[model samples]
Every structure is written in structure tokens, then in C-alpha cells.
Target: MVLAHAEHSGPRVLNIGEVLAQLSDDFPTMTASKIRFLEEKGLITPNRTPAGYRQYSENDVERLRFVLSLQRDQYLPLKVIKDYLDAIDRGERPENLPPGVKVSPRIVSDEFAAEMTGRVRALTEEQLRTESGASVPLLQSLLSFGLIQHSNGRFDEHALQVAKACVQLESHGLEPRHLRPFQAAAEREFGLVERAVSPLSSRRDAASQARAAEAAREISELCLTLHRALVQDRIARMDS
Candidate 1:
């Protein structure tokens, strides 16, 4: 088991496959690429062996369990979890962290939490259709344009904001039909990630491909998250 690098002398390190096999029963979606992506996101840093192979200790496994559980059960984004872990690493007492954030040196993981912003309210379908000219046909156009997507058969908060923008334009006789340009722009933006992650899809190995595909999804999700924040920030300036 890996302890905090600071807590004990370094011991034997497990390979990537071993790590997955050990945790797959619990985290079915855990993959080597997922592990690497977590590292890229600054969540966990496993030590490397002489040949540059990743060698995770008990601590790494425990941390992985914590992160995977949060993502699977709590629906948190990796960036949120990373921030929480970073705080505890610096000896900070995060208010949301489970009381007594301690792990056995031989055990590899512990649960924790970071401060989070609250949710934004989304406009309802009636608001979309009546105020924004967002009829079902218009909604489909937006989806075709890649400007909108369903969240459990409902439009997301960002879609509502975009729809609101359409409403604002409608006052001047511009309709949702006039927003196809936005959809085209979104397509181009999505294409950026698609091309960047194309190699992952080309790999023939099932496990390797699965992990890479997830990493790509996670990266795109992160981009969407940042994009949402930027859009909201810019909109906030309107009130100022």
C-alpha cells in the first residue's frame, strides 16, 4: 500500500494494469487513461519507476477511490475534486472535508471536499417558447446547429441563457432562425477537441481506447464548464 510520500519510505509500486484490476470491481470505469487524466488535472501524482512506468502506492489507490466515488456518486467534476485535494495537501482545513481527513499510511485514499459555488436557475420551457421564440422546431434547429443539447429531456441552464439571447433579439424582429451562425461557431469549437483527441479513437485496444475516449470526454466537459462560466461572467457585467 502506498502511504503519503512524506509518511513512509517508498515501497514497491504497482503497474497501471494492476491498479485497474484492483479497483475495477469498485470503479468499473476506472482506466489507465482516466488515471493519467486525473494526474493531468492535478488530482493525484503516482511515482514513476526507473523505466518511467507509473507505480502507484497504497495512498494513490485510496485517493483514486475517493475521486472515483465522488464522480460516480456525487456527480462532481474532476476539477472540483482536485481543488479540494490541493487544499488539504497544503495543510489547509477545508470546511467541507470530512472531519478528520486521515488515512492509514498503508491505505491509499481518503474523502474530502472543497468550497463550491451554487447552481444557477434555468428558464423553463414556457419561458423558452414564449419569451425566446424557442418552439420545438427552433429547439431542434439549435440542436442541429450544436448550440443546444438535452439534459434529461430538458434544456440546460446555458441553453436557457442562449435562448434568452434569442428572445432579446426577437424584440427587434430577429428570431431563433437568425441564430444558426452561433450553432456553426459551436460546431467549429467542438471540432477543435475532436481533432485533438482523434488518436485515442484510432487505438484498437478495448481498454486503451475506452480510457482515452473517457479522457477526451472529460477534457471536453471541462471546456464546456469553463465556457459556461465565461458566458455567465460576461452576462453579469450587463448589470454593472
Candidate 2:
């Protein structure tokens, strides 16, 4: 969602004032810093005026809403959300629901949850490095972007995509520094997610807490997917 003039045709610029006006109601805590944070995370990129002011399009606003909604309602970590968005950017529509949940318009059904395990893709470090052309620094960059995680020296399918994205960026002369903004954005997103999950974490039963955690993640994934769909649809209309 970087704020480039659409490579094809579309509404390509939106100012901060406009974004705030549009989003202020649905997202009460919405702020310039938060929007900028999303931009830093590569979640939404607003165009710059001749004077270097930020401009966000309708698409950007919707994307931000989806991102914030997920953080507030679903409690997903930024990294997981980014993977879903990245997949959409790559022209793939993720199942969106978590493991063993059915995909619906508004909620995930239990029938669908059972199938989640089959959809997961687990990759080792060597394969990630090999196929995605990700160097240690690149992996570190992905970590900063909140696009992947490192646990005991391994990564998941999300890591593979981040590695691939790095490879894609290399051709444009971009390196890790180009991705530092993502780290900053991630801090904001983490705060949002944490606040949302606090109630569940404080609860008594372990089972309820676990379910709450899963639901939070699933909800965020759904929002990200929905937002991507909306953006693409709007862009397609513009192109047409």
C-alpha cells in the first residue's frame, strides 16, 4: 500500500486531514502518529505533496481501518497481519481464518478451524535462506518489519514471504535501511494488539484465555483480508 502513483490507474493521493476526518469516528484513537506508524510498517503509504506532506487515498484509509480494527478487535501481532497483506499483494487470497475455523462473511466457524492445520506451511531456516534469497541481515530486516519471527533459529511460512520480499526489493537497490520504518510501525501495532488482548490475558480459565487468543488472531487476519479485498476492488475500478 505504499503511496506511489498507482502503477496502473486509481485515486493515488490523500492528505492527513482527510484521512483523519474519514477515520475519526470508527477509530476514536486514530492519530497522525498512528497512521504514520502504519505507513512506516508498509501497511499504508500516503503520497507526498511537493512540500513533503503526507497524502492518503481512500484505499489507504480503508487499509488503515482494517489494520486498526484487527489490532483492536482480533489482537493479532503485526507480523501475522503483514503476512496476510503481503499475500494479497502477491495476488493470493489467503483462507484468512485460523486453524480449524470456517470462513464466513463476519465470523469464523468451528468447522473451518479443524482444517487449519493442513493449511499451515512450516519451513526451516536453510530452505528459507535458499529459496527466498534471504541473508541474515535480510532476515533481521524482516524481523524489524514485523513480517516474520525468529524462534529458536527457525521461521514459519511468513518468514519465507518476507525473505522473498527482500529478494524482490534488492532489484530496486533497496536494503534493510529501507525497511526500518516497519520496525517503528510495529511498535504502534503491538501496543494496539496488546491493549485488545489484555482482558483475555487477565481472565481466570486457561481454556477461555487460549480460545480468546486464537479468536483475536483470527479476527485480525479476517480484517486484513477484507481490507486488501476492498483496496484491490477499488483499484480495479479505477483501472477500469
Residue range 1-240, candidate 1, lDDT tens digits: 223433323465677898899899998877899989988877777777678877787677777887787666555567656655654565333233332344332432232121122232344566567666666766666666666666556655567768667656767877657777767767776787777777866765443444455556567788789889999999999999
**Clashes per model (N, Cα, C within 3 A):** 9, 11
Instruction: Sum up the clashes in candidate 2.
Output: 11
Worst 10 residues of 1 by lDDT: 109-118
lDDT of 2 by residue, 1-240 (tens): 222213212555557877888988998778888877778888765667789887666656656766676666666667655655554444334434343322221111232223233543456777788889878677766666666786777676666776798788877998867876655655666666667777875675533454455556665676567668988999999978
Model 2 scores worst on lDDT over the 10 consecutive residues at 101-110
- The numbered model that scores best in lDDT is 1
What are the root-mean-square deviations of the candidates from the true structure over C-alphas? 14.9, 17.8
Candidates' C-alpha lDDT: 0.63, 0.62
